[model samples]
Target: MADGSLARMGPEHREEAWQRLGSDTFDLVVIGGGVVGAGTALDAATRGLRVALVEARDLASGTSSRSSKLFHGGLRYLEQLEFSLVREALRERELMLTKIAPHLVKPVSFLYPLTHRFWERPYTAAGLLLYDTMGGARSVPGQKHLTRAGALRMVPALKRDALIGAIRYYDAQADDARHTLTVARTAAHYGAVVRTSTQVVDFLREADRVSGVRVRDVEDGRETEVNAQAVINCTGVWTDELQRLSGSRGRFRVRASKGVHIVVPRDRIVAETGLILRTEKSVLFVIPWRNHWIVGTTDTDWNLDLAHPAATRSDIDYLLEHVNQVLATPLTHDDIEGVYAGLRPLLAGESEETSKLSREHAVARVAPGLVAIAGGKYTTYRVMAADAVDAAAVDLSGRLQPSITDRVPLLGADGYYALVNQTDQLASRYGLHPYRVRHLLDRYGSLVHDVLAMAEGRPELLRPLPAAPDYLRVEVVYAASHEGALHLEDVLTRRTRISIEYPHRGVDCAEAAARLMGEVLGWDDATIAHEVEVYQARVQAERESQDQPDDQAADASRAAAPEARPNVSEPVR
Candidate 1:
């Protein structure tokens, strides 16, 4: 089948989905459009089951979009003695790198700095040795020992006295938001009915079993009852709330652990390889992103708002203080381009510390027709999805085939490698610079042609946005027409990542992007102006919230701004 036919997911696709939601009974109805939910939809649909997926907001609007963007086996988990989790995650990482999403997931190298002399090198080396061979990490380079001079040469940003030596190893990374969206689109390609901006208000019960769901359209307030043989809940941080709606005493509890990451320009830190530093509570990562660096993550319990986890001044200071210890030139708040906070749905354990909670996921057959899976990291989303669908299989009629998602390439993965080889030719054909064409290939793969095709009649679309030159004008239009981007925030924040990558946090580009998206989404001047205004308010709120002292103050600061989609209510506590 042609790739374009794989469920357009644009405005028209969303309109058609409303008609189908109540028309037919599905074999499985999956709630949540995060990575695991999208993966579950793909897994069930691939097994020849009639499937449907519903998300309360846009795809990857929650934890899925706000990840650290690593596809690594938890190296820290190895020290925790959770070898099974590490091994499973490593296998999944390899699957994404080599088989599942070669277009999206790519290998990345990290330098583990050593402070002590004799014991540190050998100890870290031994652990890395096990990590390399555990799940066939042959696709990436193995560990290499480096002296202080060598390490400094690799990362000139590090303090000369910070590390006695270092060990460099390899892992993988991807655009988490894009990857999650691709999974949902790929599921649609395989005949699953997927709709976003649709929320499950309550569970449909047959006796004591959950038979389906009563869904409400967050956009127009339209309501529908979707009947299904079984329902799989993949709501990550919202797992407990969803469980309560099912009226089931869930098998496990989900604890919210908030993690915050700060983004700075790549020129701020002179590093060829990413850095992994050991902290008292947990390990910290200085991951390399395109033209920028992502320094992150404080593991603290989050009891406040779940939908918008605000990053406070203390949260930013905690990350800056820990990461600053190793830097030759310390990063100040002025140097930061963006700050984001995300909640990790950790499975509750005996330990009082949220950091000590389990990253391993648990799947349970909560009621007769309900299955809930929660508490896994991003790298193993496919495995978690497979397990969720497998639990739901008991209610399925016939003997279903095992998962074939391992063999099914996402929509753009098929001709990506070949297209990479033909970059110069593609550039020549499209009348774009070679570098620009290469960038499009990495982001869109074979779908780059579809995006560039939108610029054929209107040559102005090929030009870059005045404020955000890294992204072309056509991208904003294509995002609305093809990628299911419903608002200005969707394009700036996720579709192209202009929000986090820019200095003004997308304020300067908001009007231009809104205008571009308006042409495709058929928005009037008033609608475009409102979109631009809302985006500006969001950025202003985030900036003010980041300056606040604690979570409460930050949450209030953030809450002052109106949501782009107005009906997006607070998470049910």
Candidate 2:
């Protein structure tokens, strides 16, 4: 293989991996393809270990893709006295912005509105002072206190009476799905056998020790037994279920907390900086996104569906009501372009409320050769991965290296700043706008050349999708050929985020995107038609589900749609 060349997760890669299944024993096998799991694979592989990561579905198809998209110390957690957690997260955030994945994660400013006239400014300022200084929180601006007039100037969408003052602080934001996918690709680049669309049917056991896994390829129903010395479980919300499959009672239980978010057009909220407001239970965020603003997040216990968390009409109404308390122009359901719900794997505690559960993660040697990790925020995924691999190292034979992932930049991270300086020149070289070239540089960094090279002979690939002008035709093809996008949902939902950004929820561009993906994946006319139909049905189902009044009804409405891959199913406990 080319040294450090791109690990193309195309059709050819999957076939070659399928043929090599169980060919040789691995040092460690990782279960789950979410952020932590992908991070664990990279950590182990970079330490010169033979690693294999198996995901039940596509990478970041779970909670990893559905975060608030911030890499910050939980500001509210300070109120709860989670100082250590906050400090650790801030260090990780600084690492992401400066050293690790600078291309994907960048600084974002948030305005925390103050309601009370007295005692609020100093109290809030002191907390923020600690937040900025703790754990060497560098790479972002320190907290800035703003007057009521200044706050309103920053965000005219906010009502004049909404705040007495405000404090603007910087935190890093990332496309969560893209970051997770890049982590998986980085692991594969380091010689880790990263395979998606594969499910662990059962744990291979020798006496009381866990040996390996019995995995089935979800594409064609073929099964294989892969041998490994150690197995690390990073299956976030599904941690309990997988531990049960291992015939071991988990040391800690993972309770699912459902958080729902709604995407509205950027013009709806006239804000230079994102807004953060206090709620009855937790804080509400109006996060700035490209051409859109993500306002979300209702937290409640989720027991209905882990695979597909549906946002009910009540969830939407709750968000609208809380946000409208401060908005000059209230947002209605009609203004919402997209809605999504994700489950956070919280460690079970004495509190009945999911919000009160601990964000701290725990690692347990669940069995002789199995190590399980669960319950941490998305911002601390690297630390969580290091802990999981550190636990797994006990079962490994050779001299293992400590996690050097803190020093290793992600796939598109290296030389990103240099390329950003040449955005104007790059735009001139390619037949594209300067704005478009800058956008590409931010998303792909140094890898923009590789994506642009695909359009070398075929200039048509450089053009944007007719329905979805924000993304190009080559991006769809690249998602299938380079990013591990095996289905249309993979491309639309996670790879490019067309599903959440588009007003039509990717339905308008479904056929076109499927057609582009089919060209790279070698799909027949029938396969292309089927993919389009499935995506359309999914969009229809999501729309219907969002209209439902409660989670039960919403879950039922959403579950009516069929999965993109027929054989892909959640692992049984």
Q: List, residue by residue over 1-573, the lDDT tens digit for candidate 1.
A: 128456578888888888898998899999999999999999999999999999998899999999899999999898999999999999988888887888899999999999998998989888998999897367898899999999999999999999999999999999999999889989998899999889999899888778899999888899999999999999998999999887888999999999999999999999999999999999999999989999988899888878889999999999999999999999998999989999999999999899899899999999899999999999999999999999988887889789988888887888888899999999888888999987887777788888898899899999998788888999888889888889898899888888888898899989889998998888999999999999999999999999999988999999888888898665457
Cα lDDT for residue 149, candidate 2? 98
What's the alpha carbon RMSD for model 2?
Answer: 1.4
lDDT, model 1, position 406: 83
- Kindly report the root-mean-square deviation of model 1 from the true structure over all alpha carbons: 1.2
Candidate 2, residue 486: Cα displacement in angstroms equals: 0.5
Model 2 residue 95 CA deviation in Å: 0.6
Where's the lowest-lDDT run of ten residues in candidate 1?
A: 1-10
In order, what is each prediction's RMSD in angstroms? 1.2, 1.4
lDDT of 1: 0.90
- Per-residue alpha-carbon lDDT of candidate 2 for residues 212-289, written as tens digits (9 for 90 to 100): 999999888999998999999999999998998889878999999999999999999999999888898988999999
Clashes of each: 0, 0
